[model samples]
Target: MTESKDVNAGSTASKERVAQFNQRFDFGSYAETRQFLDELAELSKRDDYYPDVSFGKTYANISIDGEGQAALREMNSTFIADMQALVTKTKN
Candidate 1:
């Protein structure tokens, strides 16, 4: 798994204890990117958790956010695990 940094650390929003995780992934093609996004959507739907997602032709940027202590831990762990799995699968 790649190390993810807190992109929101210095922002004013961080004062509220809002946590965000950001990661970028590359896909072989646009079709693969779309497929990955669809998979992410399915997983998010199952977990009832959604992230702010954006993608271009062959790359995707995913950001997950949470606002409270417990929520932050849960959201970050789940998102990291799921995203790591997705990244591994797509790379193979």
Candidate 2:
């Protein structure tokens, strides 16, 4: 299995800790929410990055573990931006 990109590959002692970034997205309906999730899954597959996600009928809460190396942080930020863009496209 492929290792998670969010993890620091260096030794444990030298690992850098960062804060988590959380966001909640409200979708129009359950169908829209699922569609967003599907898009997220595709994005994750493409980027090899996946965040913690919780969802209800019309909402999804995303918690990205931003704690890691600098490259990981950048990846997380980009992932968040892409997710936001996906939501915007879904709403339009």
Instruction: Kindly list the per-residue Cα lDDT of model 2 for residues 1-92, writing each as its tens digit.
Output: 12345444564324425545678999999999999999999988887877788999999998765342255566654766788999999988
lDDT of 1 by residue, 10-60 (tens): 663544455556789999999889888988888777766667788899999
Candidate with the greatest TM-score versus the true structure: 2
* Model 1 RMSD in angstroms: 6.3
Highest lDDT model number: 2
Question: What would the TM-scores of all predictions be?
Answer: 0.68, 0.72
> Against the true structure, candidate 1 has what lDDT?
0.71
